[model samples]
Target: MSTATDLAELTARVRAHLALRHPDSPIGDLKTLPGGHSGLTYSVTAGDARYVVKAVPPGQRPVGRNDVLRQARVLGALAGSAVPVPAVVASDDRQPAWFAMDFAAGEAVEPVLDAPEVPAGTARARMLEIASVLRRLHGTDIRTPGLGAPEPLDAAGELARWSRTLHAVPAELRPGGEELLTRLADALPSDGRQPVLLHGDFRLGNVLCAGERAVAVVDWEIWSVGDPRIDLGWFLLFTDHRNFPHLGRAVPGLPTEAELLDTYRDGRPPLPAMDWFRALGRMKMAAIMGHNLRRHREGKHHDPDQERLPPTIAAMIRTARDLLA
Candidate 1:
């Protein structure tokens, strides 16, 4: 990762690389885009061509947080599929991994999901569009050699992973995370699901909507071959008032949990014990918030946005426990 002083040097490197790739077209405007947590995004233009450069953050990144190569591979695999994903242009695996892709031409409408003023019909349409896109993504064949074979379901292993994450959090901030982990493990769903490609962090925030269509589903860092229900569970958790108090309100026209589930399950088998998955999702989020807050408190990372996460963590833990109840 390049230091602040070396940002221009990094840009220059990008310019030089693009120049070689397009010998007839010299690089033009280059600017860093914002709003991502794990990596940096830059809007680059060469002559008449425009693209997005996704790069790892300046410093070391935690596991599963930043995987530029994996993201590029997934995008490449989705080429010609129904899933709306940016086309990969180039990828570099050297230190401070980075890749370039076509700039998705739409606005991310996560914020719009909470706007009470938006018309009910418009809101409902947007929510359904999100579900539709997820359906396409999950429907993608995971057996493709490039995407690799689906990993066998390991409910116990999944529980253990979240448990480790919870234990790593500062006990003072999340005393109940461990207990919730135990309860979740004990009640882990035994009936296995057919493995599908899960957009692990699917939600409004990760989608860019154009009218009633999902232009693209960005942010593929945590994507994997897993139970498709996990994605549904995570999506519902994000919008559930019991979890994200600030952003979970039911907006006008926005599809209810039942509607979203219905849309997702249209042609698939019935989903089971969704509340359990929701509980696990909340637990996972709480642990992640705890970890992020821990990082901020230690002066390891300074992010003002994280200041509000402590309350979120508490809400998440309480929500997870209540779901168990």
Candidate 2:
């Protein structure tokens, strides 16, 4: 929904914010980056330095301050940790609603459902490496003030939250999601394990890779402290496509579901409701895609990339059903 004028206003505001943060640096050409349905991202160059700026839409700002502050806090904590996250520069929760960080220079590892030309062994190794990073993140203790919080959801809480999200979609767009949700709810695993800080959305698209190695992980809007299985389940839901040819290309030799679950367990107690969490992840994705499709159709926002949502939602529903079966 941004126009030339909106871009101008955003640029001016970004310049001001940068000046306040770094008075000695000179900002250069500012260009809007693509991808993301919720907010606008810009790649700005100041002198020889490059940074990425993410800002909320005007007139549609979040109910509270910019959520990027939370992202900054989390990434800052992972600074010396094994997790590969972008470097934080400045974050503000006030007007202009933006955060600036050192732009990670690498291609985002999306289209992970498609099989790559890389050797299957290499791909599997990389996937395992990615898994290792996620494991470390899930294992880390979030004890910092303002950063640590109780688990976002208990087993019952997750069911209620995802159920509400599914019901929020218009009845016509529900597809097969409702049935899948019902099955998931009734089949909830009772021996759920301890909760930890979850990445919330740990799919391949949010991760950046250089050749066979993951360089940085991006997109932290949904990050929170929750069941570690939630993160694992989300990853599996996105990558485990049995019918798509691209799936083979995306993650060659991708770990089996059992292997991922075992990796997550790693000597810890078993999660009783792991399947339910995975189903919840699929349902959440379906709802999000449905919502975005609705937004685009209603002319609230016109994102060309989101046009794929309808079919994807259908596919997600099918996957969720299979998980329950």
Candidate 3:
């Protein structure tokens, strides 16, 4: 799949698969779309319509995050809801499961984000809009994303889930992972907040924005029904320069964490144990970075972007410990 010939073959397969779905329509070439958290994302042109196809890699297992059908199912559930998500067009359950959704007309990165040459003004309003969107997303019926009874996880369970992944990475890169996990497990939330639909890796990066507004929330690979704070805390940390080093420190235009929380709360009861959730979120990011960093080093999946994540692994642990303190 590295050579031009291989890409052409894959493109043909994608075009053929989609042809059956739109039998009478003149299907066009599959243009490779770059930069997504997971799965193979491509933009296909068919007649006057444009579609984004999310598919599991050709030779990999389609379970867990690679399961494109799971993402599509959640998108289908949230399609007509208040949440802004690309409308699901179709899904296929064959080997290397894949799904199609209408291509969102927006940039994946927010203008106010920590990148250069990217416009930066709507940062405040856009941040609040994100909070409002989260409120609607969490309000979604948890059962809609489930195959059967949805298993809702709290702090300890969520930590355990990521622990399994961290174990696959090399030990040297994750010095404080064990201790952090222990601390998070011991200090589980006492209030027992109700679970809500969580965009497990929610952040400005996962949002698709049109000008100052978020038009769609993409990358549903790690979505789940879990404690709401898991999503909120991770998202908030990106705005804070002290945590999530990948976001850098140029985000002064964004709203403060307090402001974001107040906006998300709307009229509902105050969110409980957010500090602990934010700590857990850091730990989760550390695990993800460590695991992917290891994969990158091993040449299992070569992406130079991961080369810089090693520092973030340590930063995440430090931030988690500070939050826990």
Q: Taking the tens digit of each residue's C-alpha lDDT, what string does model 1 give over 1-325?
A: 5566657655776787788778899786558787766677789998888988877766656246576777888889998789988888777777577788888887665533344244557656877778888888888888765776446545666668777888988898786777788788778888877778888889877887776678888988878787777787788764445456543555545667888888877766668888888888888888888898889989999877677777778888888888888
Candidate 1, pairs of clashing residues:
124-253
Tens-digit lDDT track for model 2 on 81-175?
Answer: 78899888877676646778888886555444533454556555566667777888887777855565545675667767767877877767768
Please give the distance, in angstroms, between residue 141's alpha carbon in candidate 1 and its true position after superposition: 1.4
- TM-score, candidate number 1: 0.88
Name the lDDT value of residue 4 in candidate 3: 64
lDDT of 2 at 177: 78
Candidate 1 lowest-lDDT run of ten? 111-120
Candidate 1 off by > 4 Å = 4-9, 57-63, 112-120, 149-153, 246-250
Q: What is the full ranking by TM-score, best candidate first?
A: 3, 1, 2
Q: How do the candidates rank by lDDT, highest first?
A: 3, 1, 2
Cα deviation of 239, candidate 3, in Å: 0.6
lDDT of each: 0.76, 0.71, 0.77
* Model 3, span 205-265: residue lDDT tens: 7787877799999888878877788889788876666564654556556678888999999
Residue 240 alpha-carbon offset, candidate 1, angstroms = 3.2
With candidate 1 superimposed using the best TM-score fit, by how many Å does residue 32's alpha carbon deviate from the native?
1.2
lDDT of 1: 0.76
